[model samples]
Target: MAHLFKVDRVRLLCSCGVLKPITAIYFCRHCLKLRCGNCVSHEVDTLFCPNCLENMPSTEARLKKNRCANCFDCPSCCHTLSTRATSIQAPSPEDSNKTVARKVYYLACTSCRWTSRDVGLKDQTVATGGWSEQDNEHYKYLQSLLEHYRSVAQQEKLDRERKRFSHRKSAYLSLTDKYSLPSLLGRKSLTPLSPYAPKGDSSQSLDMTASEATAEVEGLPDEIFTEEVVLSSVTDMEQRMASPEWQPEKTSDLYPLHKHILVKRSLRCRHCEHNLSKPEYNPSSIKFKIQLGAFYHVPEVRMIRQVELKSEVETCVQVSLCNPTPHDMTLAFLPFVPEAYTAMQQKVEEPTDGGSLNTSSMVRVVDIPPEKTDLTPSADVALPQGQVILAARDDTAEYDDQDSISSYKDDPLVVAWRRANKVGINLLVTPKANVSRAKVGFVLRYDYTNTVATASESRTVTLNIPVMVDVGTVSE
Candidate 1:
């Protein structure tokens, strides 16, 4: 009589919608799918080293020579061998230190019965142990080698410094010329002065009177001094020479005024053959540091209903500006010129109250239909509009080494919105009169100087506003 046998089973649904019972199915942890070995392809499980297969602790496995100690295989037949321990006589106490003596174990396969004694084996001590003491000695040997190389490097550095100083001294002395003191004194004494005695008074006085008469005649003008003035005075002597037509001639006296002019010629470098004339002293053309800081008063955005649109739309945005500097500043709206517009048109006018003025004539304006005029209900209404996508923000404070004003133009936001969007949208600012309802964004940028140090700062502020448009029915 047999006891009751229970069968374990799993129900699986196939792709064809049929449910079937599965027996002896293997669970695949990798694929998370059950498989009958017949349904999937598989290779035979290969035997691995027992030390590698047993889930022993990692520290114990490292000490075992990375192999299974108990199992040995025949090199010829690949068969497992059995271990056989044999006890041999230990050495006497007097000779124990002289010879390393130990009892050993040997292995042999049952099929071949290959005994260790046949191989001339003996018992020996095994280091079945703690931390190996050999590592300390090896570390000390490496440290000594490192010190030897370090000393050689220091000696080379000193020798290089001495060679550099000697070369500089030799070059300096070769460029200068020096003379002895005795040769210099002999050259100074060679110059002589006149040693003629004065003549008798009457002869001296006659010589002085004749010299005075010659000096007086030389002081007269050329026209008064010449005597051969005649229209037909071209004798044979004058005919052979060029005619002295009264054209202005540059005299030698004028040459003294221009004697200081020095002519410079281009020179080339002897080694590199590069032209040395006007070589750039500062390799980078940057000259000055433009310190930029901005403090902006918050701008106000008001929704105003204009006279031409069909619905309540944003009309005008007002921005107030104050120049907190001692001197007046001319703020330049470089890329924010009013002629650049998307949809609506605009015109700028000066405020008659003398508060702030827009001198430009190109402010944009949107036309509003005259029917729906009320914007009183929706003051803070969320307008279904997409936000203006700005480029990455880069604060100028992070760039301390940039010393030129032109570098500010390369700022991420400035290059993306101002420069790249040049043809897409119109830029408007405050103090612009007759602004339209369709244009949405306005930015104000200016430079201001501090009152104390006169250090100037730059600021840019943007405003997003709503414009009111006239819809045909006031209720809708």
Candidate 2:
């Protein structure tokens, strides 16, 4: 009996405009055509490892050169190595000896003369269509560990919250006692004056009687004022205590009445064991001042600015080290101007510096040692108008070579051009190894003088550069 497969659709058209079925036909993605394998031109496909064939997805297969993605060849010689599996056999009772069984595949690359012995095979299973046995015990253990950690974290969070609430409540009570008690006591007198007080004459009569009794007690002196008199004197004290003026010192005055008070404390870093602050107090004023000494090195370079009419032009650029450091630091400038360094060096060597330079003549080099004094400038350099100039040197001076004219190099015209065009000059502030922190000030100034009769303008533009320091490494 013969089995037949039906073509669901005709995907290609013949030259005669007749549609053709695509079943058992090869498809050409480039030509957008379908043809039987017999009618189409055939190419040999690459052979791949069987293990790779069972794994890697179709998208990954294309990226991995259509070969087995899981397999790798020897770097010394192109060779596919085999993975071996070994199993120990059980010992028989009569012989009291055991044997072993091993399985391995020999892998070799046809194009390369390389070979290796069978090493080992990874333990993996080729599953038939069925559900795997559930590992309930392992899952339960993981769940228990997760619950334990979560519960511990939640308890710690609750403890922190409780502490915060208690601190807030205590602060609230203290503030209320300080600001509210005086007003509450002052309002107590207003209640008795409220049209109540026994309607005028009765309250007046009670006050007159109290005054006469106080006068009579004052008149009786010495012998009559004995222990019984003292006891009687203390008995009426409770009546006087309720009066606002007779109460103990008001809570409002508990805090110091003075606006400014000196506070003294010592502070230290727990990690580095460094004294961040010392016991220093200013008695005249309540302010505390902290002094930190930071050392910074400013390494800058100056370059001649030249604007060219043509797309390709060479401009002379110079880098110098201004060693602000107490000790000498190494510096160098590397030009990334394509091929401009040769021209810069040639211009430096030439005796005459006669051309009017523009901003385009300046090129910035980045990430070079600040100590390097010698630099060979480029020849013909190509630059786009809006291109960025990133220049760096080992140090912070525009001119380091003693042979060069220092006075002329410090000219505002040169300095302004370099500042406006150079990239790495003020890119970042970097602290030296021994320094704690640095206060860096960067100033870019330019003087423009217009000799034209119609108009004249001169101004300076400044920019602050960020500083970055490299800290020492720490091990995990």
Q: Which 10-residue window in model 1 sums to the lowest lDDT?
A: 252-261
Model 2, CA-based lDDT = 0.27
Give the whole-model CA lDDT for all candidates, comma-separated: 0.27, 0.27
**Clash numbers, per candidate:** 28, 40
Candidate 1 lDDT at 160 equals: 36
Query: Model 1 segments beyond 4 Å from truth?
Result: 1-24, 27-34, 37-54, 57-66, 95-102, 120-122, 125-476
**Among all windows of ten consecutive residues in candidate 2, which has the lowest summed lDDT?**
253-262
Candidate 2 RMSD computed on C-alpha atoms after optimal superposition onto the true structure? 39.4
How would you encode candidate 2's per-residue C-alpha lDDT over 1-476 as one tens digit per residue? 01112222112221112223333332221222222322221211222244333433333443443444335443223243333333435455466675444333333334433333212222322221111222344566555555554444433433433454545432111111111122332323533443333333332122221114344444656666563544322313333343323332322111101011112433322222223233334323334342111112132322222112211222223222232223322222222331232232232111122112112111111112223212211122221222222232334344544333322223342232333123322122233233332212122121211122333323221221111111112111
Question: What is the C-alpha lDDT profile of model 1 across 292-395, one tens digit per residue?
Answer: 11111111111222223223443222222233223333232222222232211222221122212212111112112122212222211222122222222234
Give the Å shift of residue 253 in candidate 2.
77
